[model samples]
Target: AQSVTQPDIHITVSEGASLELRCNYSYGATPYLFWYVQSPGQGLQLLLKYFSGDTLVQGIKGFEAEFKRSQSSFNLRKPSVHWSDAAEYFCAVGVRRDDKIIFGKGTRLHILP
Candidate 1:
């Protein structure tokens, strides 16, 4: 069974703080992983993705992620998160965008003043 997992349900951090959101996946074959963010009451937007070649990929909104094949993890990281970065982040693994995109339970980020 191919699936994406996000262990954390919520995380809180102050403005201009470092952030790391964990993500894990189980797949039978080569995995195509993706990180997506969703603002309140809005559709998801792709932050980053890993298809092939590079192990570490840079994403939009100053976000990046490293793909670890040994651990099957693709954790999202931000050096200094802003208040506007507060959103629900979701991890996905699948064949393609229109195909079976298995998404993990999202992690909601809270920004403190």
Candidate 2:
């Protein structure tokens, strides 16, 4: 079965510090990668996605992710993070055949002053 893993359950970073949330997926063929952010009481927002064409994809809220096939990773990165950016990040993988998406456990980001 296909699965996703977000190694960090929680991450704390100072204001203006760079942030990186790891995401790894296991699938036989090429799978779709997605990054989503959910605020305290808000629905999930699509941060970015990598279906094809590009290895590095840009997302909303000044976020970006790089897809590395060899590593089977689609890690999200932000050069500088803000307090407003604090939220729960989820990495998802979608298979073409079943049209189903598998989500990770989720990583909660904490911003510090």
lDDT (Cα, tens digit) per residue for candidate 1, span 34-113: 99999999999999989999999999999999999999999999999999999999999986545889999999999998
Which segments of model 2 are wrong by more than 4 Å? Answer: none
The residue-level lDDT of candidate 2 at 67 comes to 96
Q: What is the Cα-based lDDT of residue 60 in candidate 1?
A: 100
Model 2 per-residue lDDT tens digits across residues 1-113: 99999999999999999999999999999889999999999999999999998899999889999999999999999999999999999999998899988999999999999
RMSD of 2: 0.6
Model 1 spans with C-alpha error above 4 angstroms: 96-98
**lDDT of all predictions, in order shown?**
0.94, 0.96
Residue 13 error for model 1, in Å? 0.9
Candidate 1 local accuracy as lDDT? 0.94
* Model number with the top TM-score: 2
lDDT agreement of model 2 with the native = 0.96
Count of backbone collisions in candidate 1 = 0
